[model samples]
Structures are given as structure tokens and as C-alpha cells.
Target chain A: MSKQFDNVSVVAKANVYFDGAVTSRTVLFADGSKKTLGIMMPGEYEFGTDSKEIMEIQSGELRVLLPGETEWKEIVGEGEFTVPANSKFKLEVRKVTDYICSYLP
Target chain B: MSKQFDNVSVVAKANVYFDGAVTSRTVLFADGSKKTLGIMMPGEYEFGTDSKEIMEIQSGELRVLLPGETEWKEIVGEGEFTVPANSKFKLEVRKVTDYICSYLP
Candidate 1:
């Protein structure tokens, strides 16, 4: 799938796939550029961020880990949630899952 | 939860929420506009399109319905699939599901 942004330039696009395992990738983008990331999986995964941000889980199950928090919280299915930037957090994926994540500067 | 496209304009954005049943929405976009849709769900959902298009299921389980085909084919999580534009199709949502769907013109 492809998307074009007339209002903002796309810094990066990725297809993340996991099969009941943990996978992590360090993301780097151009300064002042908004980044959109999508992860498609059939299991569970976790996402961590170092900055304040917004996260949308487009499918499956996800858990959010907050800074200084040892355990994760269930955000339920659908809807939207916010992660404070520069704060470390993790996205745990449960069951077979997929995600489309975008970041705006 | 929000995205800005500098190379294209957003024609519409909607938040789709589902809890285990089938849910669908008819989409209309401006001419020459590219639409980006995201479905954030926890179970399974199916999506159909009339024109030949690309679909990315960001998580969970999804089945694809082909024209003249009575049964749906399982498209595993965390990848992309295509549907021919102008063709009628259905999105069968299974389990506790959510989806983010976008159309580009």
C-alpha cells in the first residue's frame, strides 16, 4: 500500500512483519519531517519511543509501556492514544497483529 | 492519530471502531485527491474496492473477497493486498476487530 501526503512530506515508509517473535528497528528521519510507520504482524509486538507522540493501532492487540513503568497497560481495540515524546515506552503486540504508525513534527 | 501529507491533500479522515461484528462505511473523496485510511481493530475485518487498489492490514486477521467468489480467502496479517477498483466487495470483520482504511485517487 502507498500513500502520498500533499500537506507533509513522507520521511520513511516500512512494512514490518513478525511471526510470534520480537523485532526492533531504530528509526532515523530528516529533521522537521513527519514520519509514518506501519507494522503488519500475525502475533504480538512492542513499540518504544523517546519523545511525545500519538499512536494508532490499526489491528490486533497492543499494550503501551510508560516511562518509569515496569508493566504495560491495555489500550483496548481501535481509537487513539498519546505517548509523551522523549519518554521511553514500549508497544507490546498480543496475538496476530498489524499496525500503521505515523509521526508528525 | 493525525497525519499531514505535503505531497497530497487529505480528502477525508474517519475513526472506525468495531467490537467483533461487521462494520463498513461508504467513502467519497475529491477528484485528484489521495485518501489515506487506517483501520485500528483487535480482531478481523474484510475490505473491498471497486478499482484496482492496494490494501495494507496493519494487524490481526483479514479475509479478501474476490468477485464471483463466494468464500473469502485469508490474507495473513502484516502485509498488503490489492483489489480492483470499481469492483464490489465486502469486509468481513471477525473477532474483536478494528481497521483504518484509506483510498488514494
Candidate 2:
């Protein structure tokens, strides 16, 4: 929602996955909360979550198959979705997607 | 280099270049300095710098050709290079590269 996050710590190293098709920078907050700002290249990806995740898509087009959902949800530009903990979801990303994923315990 | 940068601001959006093959998150410091923590997927890329740039390679295999250079310099794992302002450089990346680029005024 905000343009930038202030007074935080960012890890220099990125969390690279899918052979660099997906990459994120870890940002730590003062409240001990952790978030990842990431980029996902256009591809199909399935991800499992350890904690509840709130994914805010900043730009791009994509279809998501959330856990326990039979139908795929489409987001053309900006959107948000929540995934349950210990759940798996599928994404058919059609464009370069920029997202912020917030982890909740 | 430090493992992390503390007490900083991070832009939520990513700067995507070369059709998302190169993407970076902008990190802002208190002293008006700027840096970009970025990843480059295996490919060839040419970039021009507006200000002097100090590129620290955290990990990767790549060859760089700075402006006015005839030979391509190789970096196997970790290395550092500087490009003068308004200069162009070429990169032949063999592996996914994680780098921190500091922009100096």
C-alpha cells in the first residue's frame, strides 16, 4: 500500500527459487515481522506455504489456484490474495509479476 | 560486505529490465545515497550508468566488458567492478548473479 517501507532491514542476498525465475529480498521489520518483495517471471509455479501469506500483486496478469479452490482466479493488474498456512497454491503467471508477500504466524 | 543493511527504506516495486531477466529492488539510505540489490539471470546484457557504479558480485560466473576495454574480464565466483559515469558495460552471465550496485554522485 505504501510506496516504501522505512526503518527496516534488508538482506543483501536474495532468496532465489525456480532457478532465478523467482527471487525475493527479505525485509525485516521492528516488530519482528518479515516480508519479502519479489519478482516472478512468466511461468507456471506451484508453491507451498509454511506460514499464512498475504500476497499483494503490484503489477501483471496471472491466474491463481488457491488451496481448496476448484476454480482459478484471475488478476489483470493489481490485486491481493491470501493463502493458508501449510497449503499449496498454483500460479500461471503470464507476465513479469512484482509482489510483496507478508508472512504471518 | 555487510550481510544486511539496517535502518533503511525499500521501494515496494521492482525495477525490471531486459524483459525481466534483470530485476532489482531499490534501497534507500539516510544519507541520500542509493543502492540496488539485483539479480541477473544467465544471459548477455548491456547497461549504461548515469552515475558511477560499484558492482559487487555476491555470487555468479560472468564476464564483463567495460567501456574502452577490448578484452572481456572473467569472474568465476565473486568479484567487484566499477564503471564510470555515462559509460556502457557488457555482461555475459553464465549463472544467476546476485549483486549490490552502489550509485555514487
Candidate 3:
């Protein structure tokens, strides 16, 4: 379920992964929900998640390799995808990509 | 000169500084104007710019010490400040900060 949230208070921590290829800042809501908004540079990166995540692309393009998929799919310009909990996904960033990841509890 | 541009094409290069305390993705325009949009973690950071920059804060708060200034001033939520070219400024991030830095030519 994709829904828009407003007035999110950001968490003052940054998560840097893959040698700084991707950097994310956490946003905290008053309802205890969490989201991470970040930008990914042009590179191939693999990410693991502890909870189910809905990744919404804000800008640029991403060639993503979802779990159990053999071919990578390109997502661009406000496209979004879901990744299940305890799984991983690989992304080949063709350009500078901006994304928002919402954690579903 | 604070202005907004639309449909910015993002460059694929990421400039990581301060051991990944700050990360920025380059956004290149068609006319060669560039901007970097990124997030700064909660820490004290010093940044030097080659050209004049107008830093627009999107969220959170920042305490900044401009060049030649002895005291740090607090800027919060949608506020902005300008830094002269070839100068440096120090920022104490009291929270996670998202900013868009526009380069003036």
C-alpha cells in the first residue's frame, strides 16, 4: 500500500553502505513509523533489509535485481517496488538516483 | 541569488567527504549549472567550496559558523545562508539535515 505522509520528523543519523555508494537519512514519524530517504550514486549495490520495505523512486533510474529474478528491471521517475522481509535486492544505478524507502510494520 | 530550476539532470558521480559524514550527488543541468543534494549526519563538519554557494535547508536544524565569524548561528527549517567563493564554513549538525546547495557562476 502506497500512501503519502506529511510532516515527518527526521532522525539525526545517517546510514552509509557499500563504501559510501549509498547514503540514507532516517525520518521518524510521530506514529512510530520510519522511512529512509537517500541518494545512490552510479554503482552496483546489494542491500539487505530486516523489515519489508517499499522503495519509491524520486528521481533518476535504477536497474534492480529483485529476489529470485534472473533479469534486472529498470525503474525510473517515481516508480516503486516492494522487498520482502529478510531478503536482499541488488541495484545497478545507471544514474544518480533519489529514493525513499518506507518500512512497513 | 536564490532561484529554483526545474527538470534538473543528475550527474552520476558522488562526492564523499569527511569519511562519509557527508555525501552528495552531483546534479548537472543542461546549461552547465550544477547542484548537489545530499544529507549530512549529526556531527560537526567543515566544508570548503570552490564557488559561491547558497545552502537551502530542507529539514532539521544546523548551527553554522560562516567564514570570519566566531559564533555559530542556528538555522532551522527552510532557512538558507550564503557562503562566499573560496571560503569555508563550519556546521554543527544538531539533527539530520537535508540540503540543496546551488552553485553560482
Which one wins on TM-score? 2
Q: Interface RMSD for each candidate model?
A: 10.0, 1.5, 11.2
Q: Model 1's lDDT to the true fold? A: 0.45
TM-score of decoy 3: 0.53
Chain A TM-score of prediction number 2:
0.97
The lDDT per prediction is 0.45, 0.96, 0.74
Instruction: For residues B1-105, write the lDDT of model 2, one tens digit per residue.
Output: 559999999999999999899999999999999999999999999999999999999998999999999999999889999999999999999999999999999
Predicted structure 2, TM vs. truth: 0.97
lDDT tens digits, residue span B15-104, model 3: 566644577655556677876777776789888989999998877688999999998889886678999999999999876676878899
Number of clashing residue pairs, candidate 3? 0
TM-score per candidate, chains pooled:
0.40, 0.97, 0.53
Q: Please give, for residues A1-105, the per-residue lDDT of candidate 1 as tens digits.
A: 233233434311222233313221112233553434343333444456655666665555767677777777775556456776666666665533333345644
Clashes of each: 54, 0, 0
lDDT of 3 at B100: 79
lDDT of 1 by residue, B21-73 (tens): 22222223335534344433334444557446666555556676766789887
Docking class of 3: incorrect
C-alpha-based local distance difference test score of model 3: 0.74
Which portions of model 3 show Cα errors greater than 4 Å? A1-5, B1-105
